[model samples]
Every structure is written in structure tokens, then in C-alpha cells.
Target chain A: MSRRSFLRGCAAFGGVTALAASLAPLRELGDYTNTEQFLQKYYKELTPSDMTKVITRIEGEVERQYGIRPHVRDLKPMDGVEFVYALNLTRCIGCRKCVHACVKENNQSRSPEIQYIRVLKMPHGSMDVEKGNHNYDSKQVPEKGFFYMPIQCQQCKNPPCVKVCPVNATWQEKDGITVIDYDWCIGCRYCEAACPYWARRFNFTKPQIPKDKINPDMSYLGNRPRKQGVMEKCHFCIQRTRVGKYPACLEACPVGARKFGNILDPNSEVSYILREKRVFIQLKEEMGTSPRFFYYFDK
Target chain B: MAKLDPSAQKKSDHTANYWLGGLTAVFFSLTIFFAFNSKPHVAAQPEIPLVDKKFLDTSPWRQTYADLVKAKEDLSDYDCYACHDKAKPPRIRYDTNQKIIIPKEHANIEMSHGTHERNNICYNCHNEQNLNTLQVRDGNVVKFDNIPQLCGSCHGPTLRDWEAGAHGRTSGYWDRQLGDINRLSCANCHNPHAPDIPTREAAPGPHYLHEASSHEPSKSHR
Candidate 1:
């Protein structure tokens, strides 16, 4: 049988051979990527074995393109660790440094729809969080009792997105983060509707990041560039967290307010914060999403 | 010339009886073979995974492995229920006693088979081969040292922040060269089965640590 036909048969059976068939087309198109940047993938098409080859090729391409041999492979998923994230609302400057870092770290579509982080500017006296907006373009710490609340997926324990998936395309892992299988999703919006944070965003168009800025260190569901018409959200930096590293947002936070660690480990910093500081979750009374993120307002 | 012979009549009857006996034997043998090969699935059984009321009586929200084992031992010899029926769907159970409904952000979000469900169910992600590794299910096949990238299927934004070093667990400094340990799966920060209540309250802040002398009108201005 032709490779495409063979791949179709493999897909019917559910395996990586089908993925190889789809990847074959990309190899031909690899020449088109003169900029030597990263390519996106459908999550279901790849297996762990396929991912290694893809990662190696990407590293070679990154070296060929940028001449910088980054420790990309060393940053792959490890065997026993569980990664988690935390944000301290007390010190965010509203400078959006983390937002810029995310844009650069992941080859995100510049389209306003694909923004991973939305820095909401709240008014000075009103803590009625409902008033924040992503469109506010005023100066830094723009006047009055205003503070910044960077809104994104809270990575809740009982993700509404995971529960409502008809095809079981999205789910939570042992480490506490929720993920999606790009290939398995039939473009159904059930997960989006179920998300109380409105954290889920649909990709209406294939993401277009400048070729030079593509981050080579990517995981299937993490930093890898995505195609059009799929739903995606925050990954908690799976590529870095898989190793003993920090996320892009935490590194970029200027005030050092964000803290991330294992809630399972009582000795961790997040655990300490949970113990010592009085923390509250947003919209705690409705859908029961146990978010890992925390916001502390300072008087 | 001869109208009918008794011997000829006897020969015809014998031939007909032989064909009928062969057909009956073949039919019965085929039926027995098919019956054995096709594993019997009782269609009469309802769609619910558990038929026993005892298992259902224990917990309305979550199912335990012990319960699964009990249900399997009680129902069938195959123990199918041990693996399939034991799936404890993560849900948000509002504690009316605390006067708190689980937050929507903390609730089970519907993911259309794109995330964990797309992978084999709870048993598939967690190792089932060895019962000795008990308590929380461990992901053996897709073994991630830390939180697996599997969480990013839906939480790409948080994962991105984690990568950029913003949201999750972190050291005091941002290092692009080194990877971060704080980035985790959905379960790292939150519970899969029990929806955790959002306990943090909004505290007021004058958060920025401004350089003390920067705003104090410079000596030149004075």
C-alpha cells in the first residue's frame, strides 16, 4: 500500500505508524522552512519515540538556523517528577514582562486571539475583579489603587474542560496539570464552555510566529507551535518543568512574587505560602475548580 | 421394464439418511465452535459499570480500588470491573456545611477527549500491572519525572508561563539556560477526585518595593 494509505489504516488501528505518514509530508515541507524554525504537531499523531526524533531534528535545525546549540534535549520530560505552578498577585507590576517572555518562549500567533497572558488593569479602590480588562493600554501602574491580575488558566484540580470532553481529548495528569490531545479533538467546544475561567481559547487560524523566534525546546502539548482550529491553553512549561527548571512566567516576574512548587510536598515554598498566608481562589462558590494559582493583595 | 425394486428403494432411503446426519453433525459443531470463540457479553446487563448496590452504597462521589475488587469478585470471574469500573471521575462536591460551593475555576472542566481521556483511562495512565505500588496511581508508561507535559493539552497558557518562568513553582531567579522544577501537571497543584476549595482571600497591597530614594525628591531638586 502507498504510505498514505498505510498511514490511514494505521490510524484506524491507532498507533504511531499513522503519525509517521503524516510527518512524511512535513519532511518534504521542511525545505520550505528556510528559516529553520519549529513545526507544530497534532498531539495524538506522535508517540514518545517519534517525539525524540522530532526533538533531535528540531535541535539540529535550531543549530543550523541560529548557530546556538541550546541544551534542548536535556530539557525533555523526566521519569519521576511532578511539576506545578503558582503566581503571587501581590507584586505584579503590570509591566507585562512575563507576557512578552511567553510570546518569545512559545512561537505564539501574534493575533490578539492567541495571547497566552492577559494582564488586566484593575482600578485603584475597587477590588471588584470583574472590572479588569486586557485592552487597557495606559501607563505603568496606571494611576490610583490599580494592581495587575495576569489572567490565565488556573490549572484546576477538577478541570471543567476535562470532564465535558466527549472524545476524552483533554484530561489531568498525576502532577496536577490538565492537557489535550490535538489529534483526538474533533474541534468540539464542549471543554471551552465548561471552563469557568474562560481560560480555554480556540485557534481559529494556524499560529504564525516569526521563524527566527521559534522556541525549539517544545513538548507535544506545550511549546510546540499549534495549527488553526484547535483549542489550547497554558501548559505550565512542560518542557522545562519535566527537567529541574522553572517556567518562563516565573522567571520573568520582576518583583519575584510568583512561587511554584509541589503542593504534595509540605516543605515546598507554595505549601508554606498556603500554610502561612491567607489565600483565596476566584469564584470559589460555583464550579469548584481547585486552581493552583494564588493572589495576595497587600495593604 | 421393471417398475420398482425393493432393494433400489432401500438404497435411495439410505443415501438420504446419510446426508441428513452429516448436515446435523456439521451444524452442531459449528455452533459449538462459534459459542466458545465469541466471548459471551450479557446484553441484559444495564449500562452502569457496577451492578451491586453494596459498592454504590459506600460512596456517592468516588470509587475505590478496593470497591472495584469487591465488585469484580462479586460479579464475574474475569475481573473486568476491577480496571474499568474503578474510574473515579474528578468532581466538585460543594460542602454545604461550609456554605461554600466549589469554585468554577476549581471544577472539573470538560475536555473533549483531547487530554487524559484520549489516553487510556485512569488505569492506563497509572500503572496497574503491580498492585504493590498503591495509593495514588503512578504513570509508568508515560513516566514523567516531574509534571508531565500532558497537562498542557488544555492549560497551554499556564504551561507557557511556567516555561517563561512566571506562574508555577520557581526559584528566586529567572534562568533561561536551566529548566524549572515548579512547572507541574494538573494534579501537582490540585486534586483530581476532590475539587479543592479556593481558600485564599484577596488581601490589599501596596506591593511594589520601590527604591526608597527614587521617589523622595532628589537632593538636586531640593
Candidate 2:
């Protein structure tokens, strides 16, 4: 063989070997799950009867795995209502109560560790979010020179995650909540990249929630046990909020720093806060996301 | 030494082999036990102190104002007539320093409410003529159930915030038509004796100080 041709042959051999080596992790597809899950239709395509069947299947799976029967529902949004959250920055003592409470209520993975809320500790003299620190480890919170701000899914009026989903797995509901269909998500994580708040959490492996500790109250679009290779986020506690109850984080707050209400109602606490308090949305002007969550100070 | 018989020499060698084998087995077992029974070593935590529990417990107002109102008849706290003579108006006494001395009967109250001993007199909040009812600064009579109004007379802005649902917590339905809303009274979260919220032990952060100090979100993501 000519010397040039011999060199070309070696290059092709090395290229083939490299490509094969790169694809080696596809062997993990052995755990890719059953045909039933693969064949299931998209969330929008599922009829009410089909949804009931899916719920029954989920209930059965939960019962089989956790040894407890769960009542899961596909709760729809209410008419003439749009949700808004108002947080009092002065009252929030950097207490992580809302974070733990949200994890328990949402049935997030315990071991692999998916938490929806991240409380940032900001210095007193500065209002810049860039200066806020999430990993502050002070013994007591509101540590003399800092104010606390918890970040979560802002549930933007114009959600970027919904805009970036490749397979149409997530969408914005009527009541101003952004929801993801775990079944439809391809786990490509484009939406995770698109989020400005770092709101989306992807299950890198099978979620490891203890069976005994699993919250029995489940919802179809909300906190039903998520599988491996899916994305989940804060759905505004859809299961409770739709049923006219306060979000778990709001109920768990000791100082009542968090507030929620229908913005459509002029009499709601959120409306009054927006009207009277010195309120600002996080990254609102720069991102133009128009978040439903509002942060306000009493002074 | 005498020359040994062939069988005797063979027997001695066998006994020596058994002894070596037994020692080997014992050492192997000892190694296995240590491997399985040893505890994993953990790094020592830094010397950061935890917040004391006393700072976090605000359970004095466990009997919220609303609850006391709803269960009014059965409650003895409002029955000021039970201990004192109904005919006589209650007397307020002051020490030589002009600080009001809490009466011996009601010495359990710990007064740390206002700065520089302001709002110290009992009759400032409690009516002199009617012991059970509260008296506002403007001399308006308010029932024990309506302490918020009495408190509002002095703390005008706070009461305004509370009325608008910006001050304390309000649980139950956000949608008022769907379900009833339970607006918590001012005294529920704050102590009448000590209105200041004490510093508290925060629930744990995502990581310990060592792991967290170096962690920061990229500015590009902001």
C-alpha cells in the first residue's frame, strides 16, 4: 500500500475506535424501563378516562413500591384566578424552614437530593441578587449584616423552560403555574439549561425516596414519585392550592414571610402588597420574565 | 538425641503442620472481623456553635387571641372578677423610682415590652374600672377579644399592616369565596410582655460551611 493510503487507513481505524468508545455508556440502556411506559401517550392527548387509567396505574405502582395506597389526582386550574406569591424580605430570617417543608410536601428524592427552594443570604447594604449567597452557614440566621431571600420557580408569565422543551413536555397552566409532564420529558435537559433561576431538577438516577417517608397525597402533574431520567420543578403546590388551601411552605413559615393569593381578586393579600409595599421582581427588568413571585420590604 | 523411627518422625512432622495451619486460620479470621466490624471515619465538624433553643420557643402565646375569644366563657384568664372585689376599682401603685411595681398577685408577668421602661403601667392597657375589659390609649373600652384594636391605638402602622394582611401570617383559603380565611391576631406571633422576635436556630443549609464557602453561582447564570 502507498504510504499516504496507509496513514489514511490508520486514521479511519482510530476514528471508528473513538466513536465506539464514546457510545459505550449506551449499555446502561438495559435499565431503560418497560414498553408500557414508552407506549404511553402525551399528557395533552390523554382523555379523562385515559387519565383515570394512568392514575390507577400510578397508584398501583406506588402501592407496589411503597406498600401504601396513594390518592393521586390530575387537578385542573380554577377559572378567573391567577396565582401570585409575595415574600416579606424583612421578616425572612434566613430560616430554612420553607426549604425542608417544601421537600417533604413535594416528595422530592431524598438521597440523590432534589430540593426546589434555595434561600440566598444577601448583605444588608446591597440589594443586588448577584451579591446574594446560597451556601451561607451562619449559626443563627439574619446574621446581623444580611437579609434572606429564598429562590424557587418564579412561575414566570413568560416561562423560558416551556419555550425550550424539545418534546413539548412542559407548559404553562391557566393559573400561572409552569408544569412538566414527567412521562413526556425526554431528559435531554435543554429546559434545565434554559431556566434563569436554575429551577428545573433532573433525576440523574432512580429517585431514592424512603417508602415509609413518601407523602401519600400525590398529584398527576405535581409531586407524584418521579422516575429516573425526568425533570421536575415547583408547581406552586398545585395539589393543595387548587383545593383552596395554603402552600405547605406558607403554612410552615414561623414568621409568615411568604404570602400567596389570586392576583385577579383586588381584595387578596398579594394585591394589597403589590399596591402598597415597595415590591420588586427578581431579575425582572433584565430577563423580562415577569415573574408571578414578588419580593417586598415593609420599610 | 536418639535416632527416631520412620513413623515417629512422620508423626512429629504432621503435628507441626497442624499447628501452622491452625495459626494461619486464626489470623485470617481476626483480619476478617476487623475488616467488617470497624466503623468508617468521619471528618470533624468545624467549631460553629448552634443557636440556643430558648431563643426559638415563642410558645407563651400558644393560646392565640382568637382561640381565647372563641372559648371565652370557659376561659378563666378573662374572669378578672374571680379574684378581686367587683365593687372596688383596681388600684395602680408605683415605686419611688416611678417604675410600676407589679402586684404580688400578678407578679408572674415579665415586663420587657418597650424601651426605657415605657408603657409600664398596668392600667395603660387594662381598664381600672372594669378589670376584665381592655382600655385603649384614647379611653375607648375594648373587650379581651378585641385587643388588636387596643394595640392598634398605640402601634398605628403595625395594625394597618396587619389589617391589610402584610404583618403576620394568614392561613386557610387565598380565594375567600371558596373557603374561610384565618387572619392571625397580633398577640399570636408577638409576646405582649416582650414584642421583640428573638434570634433563632435556622434550619440547616444545603451544605456545611466548609463545603459551602467556596460555592458560588456563576454570574453568567444571573
Candidate 3:
């Protein structure tokens, strides 16, 4: 063969090998399609029979992977119930008990350390979150002129995260909780960028929860074992809250700084806080996304 | 183009069209009926009880105070009757000769409620007649659980806030339908002798990316 033809042949072989190597990852995509997950419909679009089949398939998959039977359900929001949260700034003693409680209850990824609640220690008189410090390691809290403010997914009524989702994966529920369908999320992280509170977290790796520490009480739209490359945030503890129980963070708070309840109920604690105390939402002037979470000080 | 009966041909065509139309109508009606009649696909919410009643019962303050009071009120070791009978006890009098003198038996007790000079005596809070119980402004004897009423005699506003679920820790349930709501008594959080909540090491804060680098003391202090 001529030298030019021989070089062309060599180049052709190299191109073919590189192409084959890159396409090898497509086999994993093929595996997803082969399973029942590819046939899964959008959460809102699922028919009764489709839901049953999808849930059963997920149960089987979880059992195969985790070696533990998880009871995963798609809990519906109750009618006339708008959940609201209020934190007493004066009462919060800069204790990070709520942060760890959220991690355990929500089945957050343990390896890279994802916590829903971020307690920011702000200077005593300032409300500016920009000046707020999240990594304050003071020896004793309420450090003279500083107060702790814990921030979580505000569960906004008009969430920017939901708006920016390329796939209709994340959306606000009727009860005002913004939930992500782990199966449906494309892991684009657009929602993460859109969120103002830094509430959304992207799972970089498949969550490595200890088999013993795994929260078996899982919900489909809430704290079920999330796969890698999906965005997850606080769903107001849908597994517990939908069943008429308080969120884990509220139970874990040592100083009773957190308060949560259905705002529609006239007698609910949240309603009383809104009506009585000097209550305000974070970024209230932002105007578009009306967050259900409120911060208040005692009168 | 064979010679045929026109009426018969027409009749056959009419019958076929009628049957076709009738079938389409039936199919559409069935679809509509099924669409409307099918029940909503509400995912079966398993009745999983979320709250652990046992965990709720274990209040941080309740157990501590209960244990503390139980240890002090161990009647087997120290009896209140040994010092005073059922009749009203005498008012504590300070001897002019001595600059400061608490009873030798009660010397170990610390009276740090307000100040050393103001209302430092035991009779101020404790019912002299019954050393074991507390006393309210109305002279009504209050139980340990009802210490708030005694504290309310002076700190009325705080008592009101506590009742309104503002001043203290409330756990268990916000909606009373699921479980009993628990409110911590004043003694649960505050020591009766030392009213101020003591300082303690705060829990570790969030360690976000570059958070350590961003902690500038000069900027934060400003």
C-alpha cells in the first residue's frame, strides 16, 4: 500500500475504536429502558393500574438492590390543608439538632453529607442572609450578639425550581410542597440553580446509606432512596406529614424553635403565629415565589 | 354488471351502514362511560403510624427534673417533719451579731434566684408550713409540675407567653388529633435556683463548599 493510504487506514481504525469506547456508556442507558422504569409514566399522569405496577416494580428493584423491603407509597396532599412552618428566632439557640434530624429522617445521602436544614448564625440585629455565616463554630452559642436562623426548603407556592425544570419532574403539590420525582428527574440541576434559598441538592453519587441506618419508611415523592444524578430537597417529610405527624426537624429541635401545622385550620399553631407574632417570610420582597415558611419573634 | 334487484342491493347497503354506525356509537359510549366511572388513582397510603409514643414520652426536661426532685425528696434519708410540724413555720430572722449566716443544715443550698440581697431566703418560694412544696402569691400550695403558677406570680408576662406556646418548648404534635401535645414546665428548662439558661457549646454548623475560606473575622465583625 502507498504510505498515504496506510496512514489513512490507521486513522480510520483509531476513530472507530474511540467511537466504540464512547458508545459503551450507552449500554447503561439501554439497561434503564429494558427495566419497567422506562415505561413509568409521569407521577400525575399515572393511572390506577399503572401506579400499582410502577410501585410493585420499584419495590422489587429496591429489594434486589438494598436487600431490604421498603414500603414506598405516593401520598396525596389533603384538601383544604396548606402546610406552613414558623421558626422563633429568639428561641433558636444555634443548636444544629434539626440539621442531623433532617438527614436521618429524610434518608439523605450520607457519604457526601447532604442536610436539608442549614442553620446560619447571623449577627444579633441583622436580617441579612448574605452576612449570615453557616460555618460558625463558636465555643458557646447565642455568642453575645449572634442568633441562629435555620433555613430549609421554603416549599414555595410558586417555586422557581419547578418553573426552570426542563422536564416536568419537580412541581409544587396542592399542599404547597415542591417535590421531585426521582425517577423522572433528568438530573439537569436547573432547579438547583433556580432555587434562591440554596435548598436543592444534587446527588453526585448513588446514596450510600448503611443497610441498618436506612429509613425503611419511604415515600415515593419524599425520602425514598434516591438514585445518583437526581435533585432532592425537603418535602416537608411527606412520609410523616401526609399522615398527620410533625416533621422530624420539629420533633428534634431542643429549644422548640420550629413550629409546623396546616395553615388552613383556624386553630393551627402556624395560623396563630401568622396572626399574632411579627411574622415574615425569607426574601419577602422577591415578589414571585411566596414561601410558606415564616420566621417570627415573640411579641 | 350482472342484472340484479336494485331494492335488494340498496337494502343490503343500508343494513351494513346502520350496523357500522351503531358499532361506532357503542364503542364511543363505552369509552366515555369507562373514562368517567373509573375511580381516581390515589396511591394507596398505607396506615403507617409515624410518631413513636414512647419517644414522645421521654422529654429532656421532664426526666431530668423528675430525677433531681426524686433524689432530693427521698423521705427515707431527709424528712421535712424533722425541722417543722404541720403548723405554720416561723419567719427566718437574721442575727445582728453575724454578718451572714444561713442555717448550718441549709448551708449547702444556693439561693441564686435573683440576687444575694433580694429574696435569697428559702421561705420566699418554699411554703414554710410545707417545706416539700412551693407557694404562690395567693398563699396556695403549688405542686412541682405547677411551679409555673408560682413563677407567674412575679414573671406574669413570661407565664402568659408560655401558655401561648411562645416562651417554652412544645413537642409531640401541633395537631392534637394525632397525639398529645407536650409543653415543658419552667423547671424543665430553667433551674429554680438559677433562673438564667447557662451557655453551652453549640452544635457544629454547616460546612458548605468554600465556607471555611469565607469565614473572615474582620468582615463578619464589621
Best by TM-score: 2
Off by over 4 Å in 3: A1-34, B1-79, B82-111, B114-119, B208-222
Misplaced by over 4 Å in model 2 are: A1-32, B1-61, B68-74, B81-100, B103-107, B115-117, B207-213, B217-222
What is the Å distance of residue B216 in model 2 from its true position? 3.8
Q: Best lDDT goes to which candidate? A: 2
Superior candidate under TM-score, 1 versus 3:
3
B1-222 per-residue lDDT for model 3 (tens digits): 989999999899778666655555555555555445444333332232222233223255434335566567554333566766667675565668422356776776555577554656666788877777778758889865577888999898788767866667777666677787777778777777666667666554443222235344322210
Worst 10 residues of 3 chain B by lDDT: B46-55
Q: Note the residue pairs that clash in candidate 2.
A: none
Worst 10 residues of 3 chain A by lDDT: A25-34
lDDT per residue (tens digit) for residues B1-222 in model 1: 878999999899777666555555554555555445444332231121211222112112233333445466443423434544355433324354432343564356332233333432444333454422322333434323233354553456655545544443344322223443433334434434332312221211111112225533222110
- DockQ ranking from best candidate downward: 2, 3, 1
